[model samples]
Structure formats: structure tokens, C-alpha cells
Target: MADSQWVDWTKTTQSKNYRGSGSFATFMIVGPVCFFLGILFASFPYDFPLLWTSDPVAPSYYDQLETHLRFVHQSPPLIARLLNIIMTVGFLGFFIKLFRPSEANVLFDGASLVLYVIGAGVYIANIVKGMRAVSAGVWHTEDFKGIAHDGPLTGEIVLGREDSLRVLSASNTILALVLVGVLVLQAGQWYAERREAEDNKKADQADKEAAERKASASAGSGGSGKKRQ
Candidate 1:
């Protein structure tokens, strides 16, 4: 059984925009990154991980190439989408847990959701088809530049119709615009919530002060208002 630790999904860890660029960005950016690296690997299998060392911490080799495709790239689109859906859930958790203030958060949540769906659709297709081509030697794992390669690679890779991919690529551009919208909305919500909270706090303080003043006046006046004459 998997680790039984409980996880909460409501507390955001980063900005809504941070989460927006999340899964979609991974599929959008890294999908192509892998293709490029796959090409590099196809062309120079020995030097694959050298050129693409990333920031803060380096990307794992399996991550660079997409480890899941090692076996399941042949499943139907629905099945792959199922896998994509599961992973996207985690991506969303990253968004919800860190993203707060609902202003940007909700908007990004929508964008992230859309990204998860669309990007996953495209990526899963590409990965499955691309892997077949690669395996058949049509797209050399090291065909980074495609300048040199034995004819062992199959034609599906070299001559594959990537027009659908172009359409799929639109998911990134759309998600990016949505992320901006999310940021704007998040700011608005933050400002509104902050103002409301401040107003409530101030009102409570004012009421307390008024009560204290009333008590002080009553005590000072005592019962000898008319000098007891």
C-alpha cells in the first residue's frame, strides 16, 4: 500500500500564477524539451544530459526523457488521458495548497484545469506516437540536428504529420493568457479581502473603545449628579 499520510488541498504554497504555469507548463514546455533532448540523445546518446542542466536543481534523467513512455506509450488515448488526469491532480494540489486569496487562485485553478486537460491530450498523443517512431529508428534518439543518422529510423517519425501538434501547441499560449487573467483577478480579490478584514478589525476596535468611554463616564458621574441636594 502507498504511504498513508494525509494531504490537504486547500492551502496554496505559491502564487496562483505560480500554479498556473504548473502542469500545463510542464507538458507544454517539457514535452518539447524532451523532443529536443530526444533528438540530442538520438544524435549524441552519450552527451544527452550534459546540455540541459536546469536551475536550482538539475532535472532527473528519467524526467528529461519522460520515464512513463518506457512502457505504456502504446495505450489508447483514453487510457493515457487517465494517467494524465491522475498526475494533473497532483499538479492541481500544488496549485490549491499554495495558491490563496481566491482572486488569482480561482482563475489559475481554471487555467490549470484547462491546461491539464488540453496539454495532457496533446502530450500523451505525441509521446505515444513519438516513441513508436523513435523505437522504429525513424526518429533517432540522438537525432538532435538530424544532420547525421543511419537510415534505420522509420518513416513515420521523419514524415509524421505534426499539424495536430501545432494545434495542440496552442494550449500553452491560451493557458498563458489565462494565467495573466488569474493574476489580475487574484490581486483584485486580495485587495478586496484585505480591505474588508481591516474594516472589520477597525470596527471592533472602535466599539471596544466606545464601551470603555461609556463605562469611564458612568463611573466618574457616580450617583451624586445633583450634589444630593
Candidate 2:
């Protein structure tokens, strides 16, 4: 009976932890999607006109491009920093869970952590680096010969800047999708484990019921034999 109680407690605690982690993973997934959507909304004003323009490098056209890039450089880092903090906490939680004796789904947790780390790597390598480059005036690098030059930027320089922005946006969108995939994996694992637990509980209850029935039958037979004697 004591052993059964312990097993029940363990299963209950494990189920709670699994559900909590799944909820956290859902939050992580939502963060990236919202960030990407925000970027699209913020850039739409300039991007829409630029998309239809024939001369993207013209002073008038490139000025709007610069404005867009400036917004990208300035706005995203704040949200990125916040997301990074949340991700770091999530990573540490999972990492700690890896060594926990109570954690039954080691493979599932390990796989989720691996994918989470990969997503972080992509963010740092592509998204973070791209933003830093934009902040450092990538457009004026060649024209100003590594010196800071202020004023209207035009010609191929603006075109290069536009291309970099596109690449940055694309990479960020991909990263968000990858995070969503991780969330899906976590959800699936949680469902599988929950189902397994329910099945185990049912099996245990069935065995207990069968043993009780057998004991009652034995007691009835013993009483009848004594009365016959």
C-alpha cells in the first residue's frame, strides 16, 4: 500500500510538471510569431511603396528605406532582449529536468532542448548579426570607406541595404516557424505520456479489483467447509 501511494504521487507530480512545461513552450512559440507579425506591420508603410518602385536607389526611395532600417535596428533589440531572457530561463529549466530522476520523458525533453538550442543558434547567428550589421551602417561601409558619413544614401549602397533587410526578415520568419515546430513536438509528447499514464492507472485498478474478488471467493469457500465439518 505504501509503495502504491508513492507511485501515485510520482505520477501525479510528473503529470503536473509535463503540463506546466507544455504551457511554457506554447508561450515561447507565441512570442516569436507575434514578433514577426509586428515587424511586418511596422515596415509595411515603407515596404509597400518600395516594392512597387522601379528605382529603389533613388534619394527619395532610399530615404524611406533608411527610415525603415532605422526602425528595425532600434525597435527589435528591445523585444529580442526580452525574448532572450525568457528563452534562457526555459533552457535552464529543461536542462535541469534532464538530470532529474522524476522525469520519465528523458528522450522527449532532450529532443526538445536540442531543437530549442538550434533555434537560439539561428537567432544569434543570422538575426542578431544581421541587426548589428544594419546598426553599424552596412549601407555606407563601401562608400564611406569604413568612416561614418551622414546624409542621403543612394545608388547600389541602398540596394545592398534593402537586400540585407529582406534576408533578415526572412531568417526571423523561419526561426519563428522552427520554434512553432518545437511547441508541436512538446504538445505531442505531453499527449502521449498522459495517455500512457491513464492506461497504467486503469491496469492497476483492474488488477486490484481482480485480487479482491479472488480473496472474497477464498473466504466464502473456507466458511462453507467449516460449516460442513
Best TM-score among the predictions, by candidate number: 2
Displacement of the residue 94 alpha carbon in candidate 1, Å: 5.6
- Quality of model 1 by C-alpha lDDT: 0.44
Off by over 4 Å in 1: 1-169, 181-189, 223-226
Number of backbone-clashing residue pairs for each candidate, in the order shown: 21, 0
lDDT of 2 by residue, 15-47 (tens): 655433445644554455455446546655555
RMSD of each: 13.6, 8.4
Candidate 2 wrong stretches, greater than 4 Å: 1-66, 75-81, 101-103, 140-159
Give per-model TM-scores. 0.35, 0.62
How far off is residue 162 in model 2, in Å? 4.4
